[model samples]
Target: MAQVLEFKLPDLGEGLTEAEIVRWLVEVGDVVAVDQPVVEVETAKAMVDIPCPYAGVVTARFGEEGTELPVGAPLLTVAVGAPAAGGPAAGPREGTAGGAAGSAATSGGTTEGSGNVLVGYGTSEAPSRRRRVRPAAPVRPQAAGPAPATAPTGPDRTGARNGNHEGPVPVISPLVRRLAREHGLDLRELHGSGPDGLILRADVEYALRAASVQERAAKAPAVTPAPAPPAHAKAAPEGIRTPLKGIRGAVADKLSRSRREIPDATCWVDADATELMRARAAMNAAGGPKISLLALLARICTAALARFPELNSMVDMEAREIVQLDHVHLGFAAQTERGLVVPVVRDAHARDAESLTAEFARLTEAARAGTLTPAELTGGTFTLNNYGVFGVDGSTPIINHPEAAMLGVGRIIPKPWVHEGELAVRQVVELSLTFDHRVCDGGTAGGFLRYVADCVEQPAVLLRTL
Candidate 1:
């Protein structure tokens, strides 16, 4: 007898709560194998194919392409084993119990299957479905249930009423907590709209906007606040209004968060790269595998990090401590058609130039194809951004947040430079280092930048550490 089972959209890690249906690989009545990819989804992190855990005939698909679904929403239903005489599960999808999209009427006992879903996510046990509750006015949510849409408004029912409650706030995403902390919003004072009273980014943002509006309203009588310019103040310009979602939205949120939370500063220096370029050429000329210029710069970065360990650390605000990482996982900025992504090269401090070049190549290719996993996309200790490909001379790079520093490399072009007391057309490059002021001061930043410049001016300087 066939036992029907349902597959929910599994959690794609890195704190992603939702994904948009990019493409569907299977249709109803299609036979699929265990661990077969059933759908392609675009999360804020990347585009990935989601494999199903169960091996069965697809009985129904839930959401259509382009539908943005929260994590754990029903994806499809499958009919396992041989069919019953009437074959009740062979028909089109019907609504499931509790208003979930797909039918669960034919669902029986749990069936064991492979749990591989994504790199860091697995889907064996069913996850709870997420629902957005739009209460009349948000009530201080309890961990047990959601507030009704007709929740009471006014100070009497404000979240501050539960401020005295002794329990940890229900927040699963670190990003959401960070966003709230940046704005000085108390999590206990905001009602979460996620499942089981879980706090989400949207909830924090909404609360901040509401607070902003109220602040202006409160000051309206004291002063002529909330400007209403002359009748014709020029309507806001409008063009194509693209919804910020997927990778683009993720980048926007992260960059904004970084600017909000981090006190960062930049220092740049111009260097004679004649010897560095010549060194790379020499290595290639005598080579097993050609080393990339980026790899050489990366080697210099790792060596400098060893000398100035403060630049290889992150500031832990809550713990009031500086975490100096022993190993470097170097991330390089990659621009692809999808968007800009940073793929980290693990144990970068230990690897030689050849290994770094190969890993960078592989990760870059994966990033361009939108196939890089969540683990590959995160856990960067430092970043190396080569903006030279754009033919630019320099830029004050924005430090990638949480990480203490970033090294920016500009065009290594032929310029008239004074070398050994003589002016000549020599290869020159500009290097910029942006560091978090909380982690290190200007002196340390300067020393790190100077070390990198020294390595570029004289390649033998790196050999001392090598």
Candidate 2:
């Protein structure tokens, strides 16, 4: 009889029920080596490529692209000798049970074609299936130097650093990968507590938050109540309120959580935007598309992040941690026909004003057309919401969830002001920055807003900061 070996989709991480297929790297009949890239999967948090562990000829794809497959479901089947009659194994494989893995090895004996499959990953339960059992203890390699004393001692692998391992291996699903990438976490370093060492999305989130807290102690100063907003009459409701269903819906949830969970402290600064307006007009005269005050604000925000790193941070409420980011992925609120959208500008600190303006244009157009993907909407460190576009003076804007702060930009209008002890008309814009009181103090928020104002009033100041 011909023997066949089946490859089931392992539980990429703990608590990862399902994953969406993004792309397939291999085709049917292609000879793949162990650890070769075979498929790409997308979870809620990130995209990860799965490598093949056993070398064999490609057989068949589990389903079409974008298909959501449950954990332990057979993804592909490869024949070791003569091909088997049935399709890929259905349900969790014998040793690969996610929920109750300890009982799998003894219950199902290894068959002739079955290879040593890692248990504790997910697999379907079927009567005909056999379990390939390995040694009780996993063989871990030693490092060249003495192991760090701070290594966590636990059954969970999250805290365990894997800087030593190499080679292809089966792992958790897309959601776990996404969570790890967003929080700048290392999945390999994490010692998973889930069945068979599968890292769960929640596990990654917990690790990230723990890391963030350590950073906050190093950055944040003593917290103080933010200065109160200037008293004004109940502002008449003039703007439209649209329902946020998709991208906007996500934004709403994030902001609501930030406000409800974290203590918010807001501060204000007035900036003379005359120089930025003149600079923009000159650029437009040189054949560039006319950039708005909001675009100029984006450039200033990016520059500010480079000068003050603490402003670009995220607060983990559950972990009681704060993570300061080095890169600036500036997110600006774009009001479109659909609703309010904040398309992110990746690595904002790396791009120049011209390049930043161009990128905003592209993202805005894409967002308005309803073509932005999930990746585009993820990974924002700081956000800018422009109420000026609709001709408002200013209001304390809510912070985006996860992030610690958001800058609100108001309209630039000619106003009477004293310059050098003389009353004159000057172009002025109100800037408000609302930050999580738990993560940042009043002094830090004030300093950050002042820096942004200075950059706006003198656009050339960015030359040194950028």
Q: Against the hidden reference, what TM-scores do the models get?
A: 0.71, 0.51
Global fold similarity of model 1 (TM-score): 0.71
Pairs clashing within candidate 1: none
Best by TM-score: 1
- Candidate 1 lDDT, 1-466, residue by residue in tens: 5556666665554567789999999989998875578999988877878766566689899998999987655688776656457863332222222112111212121111111111114222112122222223222212213344543322221344335567656543444566788899888886554443445456677778888888998887665557778997899888989788998888888889889888999999999999888888999999599899999889999999999999889888899999999999999999999889888999999999999999989999988888877667788999999999999999987777889999999998999998779989999999999889998889999999999999999989987898
lDDT digits (tens) for residues 210-234 of candidate 2: 7888799789998898987779847
lDDT of each candidate versus the true structure: 0.73, 0.64
C-alpha lDDT of residue 154 in model 2: 40
Segments of candidate 2 deviating more than 4 angstroms: 1-249, 287-292, 317-320
| TM-score between model 2 and native | 0.51
Candidate 2 lDDT for residue 49: 65
Stretches of candidate 1 above 4 Å error? 81-237
